[model samples]
Target: MTAADDSTFLNISLPTGTPKAERVAFLRLCTALATASLDPADAIDRNLWFAEAGLGDLYNKPTLAAAANTLIDLVEQGWTLSTAYKHGPLLAPPPSNADPVVEKARVRRQEHLRRDPQLRKASVRRFVEGMEKPREFKGKLVTVFNLMRDGRELADSLTTAPDPGSVIRPYIQIVDGSRCERTGYLLHDIWRYFRHTWSNAYSTVPGRSMPILIRDAATPHHAVIGLAAISSPVVQIAERDEWIGWGTDTFLEEVRKAPSDEIAAWLAGRIDAQLGEIYLEDLLADNVLQPTDLHHPTNEAIAMLRADAERHRQKHHRTPLSEVRQIEQDPWVQRATSHLFRSKRAAMLADTLEASRTLRPFFSPKPAADGLCQALSDTKAKVQLRRLIRRARGERVGTVIADLTVCGAVAPYNALAAGKLVGALAVSPKVIAAYRAKYSRPSDIASSMAGRPIERESRLSFISTTSLYGSGSSQYNRLRWPAAVMGGPNDKWISFTELGRSRSFGTSHFTDETVDALVRLSRVKGAVVRVNSVFGEGVSPRLRKVRLGLAALGWPSSELLKHGRERIVYGIKLVENLRDYSLGIDPAPEYLLDPEQADETSVGVWWFERWGQRRAVQPAVLESMRRHRLVRPISHGARVPLPTDETDTTPTESMFFSADSS
Candidate 1:
């Protein structure tokens, strides 16, 4: 329909009036009588055909006029076309009221059946399988695997000797049977057993057997697996050493005390134990005995002694090397020796650091008589000095600088450019002495620091820090809303730093860059309004409102949103920031990084299309939009851009360089 005079008319609500009984009857009669005398079988088509055939000749036909009069009478008597000209008292009295009650019960029963556990399980499976891309199922599979790993550990503990009728078989079956969609065959059996064990298994039962056990536990089946998979978390907290150690400490002690002949036998029996349990056994044995065989002991006592003796004999029989030059001749042996030395050093370092906290306060020495007088003025400085000294020795200088800047211990400029600040800090006498001693020598400070010659610059495409949004992340953007697009400048066109400290740009210079990116992204142009939080300490609630509002606007499916690779990456970053901020560890916000814009996807574009259609751009506006390829008419209305095929192989750069897209 043509729009009314006002632009507001384009937004009219759909009419909802229902026709009266008399009017409905009259229309039905006219339609039926016109169709070959209302033959019910050929009603619609024949009526139109007959109407065309007889309308011209109706003036000359008296009989036709009488038939028409009869039709008019039927209509006047309130006979619909389906009533066949009879207005008789209905043969069947107003449908038995019981029928409706019966129908309602039937409908309820059908609904119950549809949601029946076995049926719903099947449905859930089908639903998951039908998903073109299945991330939830993938996550669930990981959960299942983790559960299986834990179950395997527990299963090993359950059995001492192999049995044909082992519960391990059923246990493994149960684990494997747990599906991403529903509890599988064996798991369902286990679930049934669990339900029988617990009276409150299903919500339907109180003092009786739960009638809807399957239905009640049906939805939470995968959830149960999920809980089990991560169940190790609390267990780890409860028994950290036992949880992390491959074998039990007692089991390892037993292995260590065992005769060399028995070590292999013990290991053979204990390989199936938890990793922590086995690891302890090996470690204890290494501590007490010589480093005989680095690999595992043999499976049999007799075999183990022979292997041990042979290794020992061979070691004693080999020629010894005294010089470093001799050691370099055997590269494999040198590498192994180096690895051993490095590992031992690392362990020593870890132990030293753990103990250093206690030792860091003071060395066991009295200072000179003048020190006592000077120390009184420097107690607080001494404590700060001790911390700085320990940090200089134990932590990376760059990390210390960054933390100091973030915590406002030092200015950002002073931290990044560290010459004068380093001289002023007065951290460790040892660290300072080493630096001063080196720089005081007749050697270049830069050469000493690098200790190597520089190579030619690499020719590879070097992605700069500015070009990327996140560390070790992808470089794609997914904002597709017109408002989101227009809110920021396009990639090459806009520099967000020019906007100054816009709330949208956030506090950091990096945030301004992020704002620029969002502005440049093609989607930020059509936001109806920006809502700020009226309450709360942060903008989180307002951000949530935007999310839910867009969702109501028919946000695309999870799959569609997932398909926007760049958008998903940004969304992940946004969520990560939310988490980091909660933990007081916010990364400097980068350019074009509006949390809402960052989280927007191609799916969100679909939502804008849905909301935009209701408040349509007029013909003149639509035509203008067409020039920019923003909108296009389909059968009834304009259609949105659908996702493109991944394998199209059309060069992305080519498409990007093309004219303004709709």
Candidate 2:
């Protein structure tokens, strides 16, 4: 199975010769067969499974054998074994055909449902329960409890003659977290049932979150036009990070270089805070400490350290600071450092300063800034200024910006492009204010872990979302707002510009049950699981679990974690200087938009005139509304979309890697 003397994956061929596409396809076909649960000794079952999965058309027995041989060739040529999925659709990647996005979603759904049978039933059950007390108004379904007092014209207004804005006043409402009866429940219901084709399990969403409903600002029955859930943005987006320069080598270098003397003086003044972050980093680099020892020494962290020290003792090594094996766990570990430890710590700090960005995650801003502050004669102003300037890399990005995770209009409103309205209004001042208020308090988990209230700033910088499909988007396309109206300078504006394609690597393709198993397996393996779903620990906890879990299962982390299904990344900068602000260079963020200058009412009016009215006048829209009124069994536009093929789909909520993901 080894490659011929000079063969590589791209250059390998059948004896008769094969093109590059054909070779990749062969490798892809080989990869699919290899991952399947067929008997390794039996070509029959492998070929059968490949055919059944619809990947056999381009492959046959001899070609499939050749594919396997080519795979061996690849392995010989240093092709990673675990990322076999990357070679091609492991099993039925989207075919080049009409509605490929929908088709691909169908494949994903089929795989999920195949893994978990109850997902669809549960989704339908919850959806039906939400409509348990349905009240039909014409053909469209309605319920008393679900009704908003928004001024969306009912029935007759479906074919309304006037500009819909005058008769139908639209506004945005932040879902009241304290109450789940109206906006909250409706938001969840609509998002779970309406927007996506792959999955819509909103309960899976995590981190500090804000839910918003685009509603008609009317009394007695405000119709819910759309819903959006804003939470923490994904911390690692290559394109977005490249755009903002967060934690990038160049940005961190510039910041460090700008404060040239301060950086040097800080490294010299206090090598380690009483916390021993520096000592821990030195030990960690030398395989002497675990990541758990980074912060305050909790009982669990101490337990890990003790276990490791015990192992070291077993190996006849009396490591310095090993006395902590018997020390009662405390908030901070007080170490009487040896000259060796001190010199090693100093060397590590020197290396860290030399390559700050490369090793930024392991170091904390506080210890370094403390040292700098002390070196600069620690006065209140100097300390505060140093703290402000030396804010950690991930902290601001985690709290200051949010993602428009679950966003879209229901069917009836969707027909009017109200989803676009939802997109525009999602980034409105209402969302910003709501986010600020909701997360302004000290974080619960963070406070508990640190043994103090960790008050984090909730200054919302901008909102970002990804298109459902990788190919393109229709909803947030050209979704723009004038900055002048938003209290910014006349020349500026706001809009969700397509940032770029997000990394087509994630665990969304894996089912929840599958991920749960992977996590369990990962925990059993002992080293793959890192972030403990702890607040302020890291971004994308679920992503961490799934990816690490895969490694626990002995799969290639990056290759299998990769779905290769890229979604469009879109973002808007609420602040004039998102990059500088994210880097902590700007002491105060200059907001490009303000809540006072214009509210949801104004955004809705713009939506109404700009898109809704025009869409309403279309004969097609009128006919659709008329049909909606006549249908016996009312759907009410909350009908969930499925991959058109309707193959046994996984629970069709939103397989979008979820909200906090983006």
**Which one wins on lDDT?**
2
Estimate TM-scores for all models.
0.15, 0.62
Give the distance in Å from residue 247's predicted Cα in candidate 2 to where it truly belongs. 4.1
Whole-model lDDT values for every prediction:
0.23, 0.52
- Which candidate number maximizes TM-score? 2
State the weakest 10-residue window (summed lDDT) of model 2.
653-662
Stretches of model 1 off by over 4 angstroms after superposition: 1-643, 646-662
lDDT of 1 by residue, 1-662 (tens): 11122212111111123124333433343444424243321113323433543433433432232223323322222223332223311111011123544433332332222122222243433432222111343334221111111222222322333431221110001122344344232444333322221111111211101011111111123222110000001111112222212123332333334324233322222212211111122223534222332222222322343344344333422323243224233333232233222232223222223222222222214223233223223555334323332322221111111110100001111111111112112111122222223223221111111222212111110000111111211111221222223132234211111101111111111111222222222123333323232211113332333343323323221211111111011111111122112111232322222222222222223322433222222344333222321112111111111113443222222111211111
